[model samples]
Target: MIEIMRTMVSYLGSDHKHTALSGGDHLTCEREQGAKRHVQCSNTPGGRIEQLEPCIDGWHCVMNFMILIWQKLHKDSQEDYGTLSSLFARIGCSKAKKPKNDMHTCQAAFLKVFKGHIVTAGCKEFDIEGHKEVNQSLLSSVAQTVVKEFTVIPEALLGESVIDSGDKVHGYARVLCHFASLVLLFVDAWKEGDGERVIRLWKILMLHFHAEKKTKYALEALRLQFQLATLQPYLSHQLTWGRFINTHGGLGRNIPCDLHNEHINKLYKNIISNMGANFTKTASTWAARSVSSLHRISMAFDSPWPLTSRLTSTVKQQLTARGQMRRTSRQL
Candidate 1:
């Protein structure tokens, strides 16, 4: 990345020289100096916004740190519960394949069966398939979609937090969802440069975190709070992170999430899982399918992707028949 930036700035320098010879406007010498400084030691930033953005986003900051907390917490919980439940056992999940008992397969078949996700639990949704590292895009979407949806109160349920703490299933789900929401909000505030808002969210969740003081998550939360408290004085004066950009030159809009180029990752994983060792002619096959999918989306997305679709009529009938068969077998 440093090399790329060096090449880019060098090219920009040559371009600037040409513009100056042609009597065109050019970057000031100070701007050139700042760009060079930005590419230097990323950790010891020159405090310029140009230097700050790449510096902040280049290394793992709040986003990476918080994700590590969530990933470990989520994984540890999953290990105790063991394998994911069968799709047919999950109420609203797709009913397509036989008892292979695979969550990934169920997710894939869901597109065909219901034209949507086969997710039974909203708050528990995670990316990275539990085998890989926590994915940044997954974390991004979870905060926006999953956490947002879970936290928003319905009009009828407004002003009520009636989830029974004693109830095993719903109680646990509620706590997980609420905590996830807190983390995401803190993350969003930091990313958007709302320092006061970040501190406010931390304060709101402070009591709840204290209540769970025995947990590792609470320790992580407190550690984060301490870091934020130290920054409170600076944040009060600085206000938005954009101010840093205006005054300095470092903190830009790039995140070193590292998943920016992984379309082939998905393709290879899918082909290997679905095709196994029989990969002869499979490369061209999936590639053609990929192109065909692109063409369909370009010309006839509405046909392929309806605005609304329910469980297919045939799948519904099959479910009913299977229910009847189970009943008869139980009776016999």
Candidate 2:
């Protein structure tokens, strides 16, 4: 059986030159003399085996071979008749002096070959339309088997298997499906008023992904939580604003300042507000501190200036500190 399967797979895998042997709606028996000559005698005393010529239409032979194999393996019901009938009707003629027309015999021959290959098997006939139903059932069974295999990994991992990059991307898709399912469960819990269960699932999700990827998955998982209203407090706080700022580069600077352009100022104000920061106050404080530090640093650099002399000793020390800060900031 394995050898037969291997041979079939090889044929299916290859598209190279090979003789086509079609027994379409007709089977032909070879004359024993010619058959023996072709099979055994490559070069007789005269030359290559005589009277062995290629078929008139060889593609017919190849199609017949494929259909015949499919029919014998899968076509057993009355339903299959519709599918295989046309092929069955085109059986080849016998390969002999008086070649006989016997398409049914050819179909039977194909079935016999297939049956012999797999096991002691017999065709269990069924109605033609039933073939589609049978096919659907077979597909369903295969799908179930694959899903069952996939479901085992989560259970085996104790619900902690955070899919790493080491896992296949297809497996990552499956993990995504699993996480999505968990999100659904959390949703159900919320719908049922099971607040604890919702929180529990959210925490599990966070912990699993957190431990796995060092918070790489945190934002995405939390985003899922937001939709469910199960995201933990401080998690939103933990949502690093750097992600947004870094995205904008220098424009990502969080410093707030009075802008002459209303559009630009409003845009900055909106962004800071949405990020849960006090835009006006935060910006003013930042700017004020920046100016103060600049003034002090300038005094520290050029001593005994008119404004520098009036500044207090404490202010002078602040200027020295600010000068150091300016130098450090520039280096950065």
Candidate 3:
């Protein structure tokens, strides 16, 4: 998802020179340091990167997508860019002088911004009109807020008729909303353990990739399709190792292999940071072991509490409301 999002931003944004396809065959994009890189874009059999790497968290995918959209708008939109900049600022994401060139700044800003959007029991709706408090933590809520806020840019620029506008910026915003909606639906299906629905939505997402193939983003589209093809089997069968736990007591569904690895990496980083940057490797290992033990102990103690149930119910209600809004919007 990160790779796909990065490719999309690079290809779709105003930086055309960086992502030129070579020989109309393979995918080639210039790296940050101006070096040419080639990526296999064919449908032929190859090693899937996800198979070897950790699954990126769904939130990370959405975050990257949101940041990419912001970057795109910063580059392309002139009249309404300030609106987005102000909206981001409301969430503590300060506007950078050069949003397109300073990706690190954009990323850092959104990370802080997302910290407030992390799923929690007291999540609140994001009101664009009043710039209301955004305290939601559910993945769906974040996606919904992203769609609403991003849709504002085009709407502000092209008015209520923005949806009918043939402008490039409008198209990008619409694509962003569509992608976010699909991802939220995918997450809902995955949480519900609905493998069929997951596969269906994934195919729909692949269709978007297919649509991009005829455009300037053809190489990126092809490369994305190739990289994500491996997940089809796992999505279809829902039987891929310990990651796909059938027991409802354990995460309620299959946790992607990457989530676990990423969580551990995050935990390790947090632990190291807390250790004040001068700890020995052995000390860090022991500290990590202790933290793990304490975490298990705390979970065991909290298992009997009703807080978990309440939080779950809250999340469900939020998701249901968001789903209804999506359905209503589609019908209209």
Q: Which model scores highest in lDDT?
A: 3
Query: Compared with the true structure, what per-residue lDDT tens digits does model 3 show for residues 1-332?
Result: 33543443443454332221111111222231122112234342121211222222222332334444454444433344223354344443344435344544564443332232322111333324222455456647666554554443445644454344566643544454444455556555655666455445544544544453433233333433443465455431332222222323655565443444445567777677877757897887676667656666777898897773334433322223333333223221
**Between candidates 2 and 3, the lDDT winner:** 3
Tell me each candidate's TM-score: 0.28, 0.20, 0.38
Task: List RMSD in Å for every model shown.
Answer: 16.9, 38.7, 15.3
Q: What would the TM-score be for candidate 1 when compared with the true structure?
A: 0.28
After superposition, candidate 1 runs with Cα above 4 Å error: 1-158, 161-167, 214-235, 239-332
lDDT of 1 by residue, 95-119 (tens): 4232233423333332222111212
**Poorest lDDT segment (10 consecutive residues) of candidate 3:** 19-28
TM-score-based ranking: 3, 1, 2
TM-score (C-alpha, index-matched) for candidate 2? 0.20
Candidate 3 residue 158 Cα shift, in angstroms, is: 24
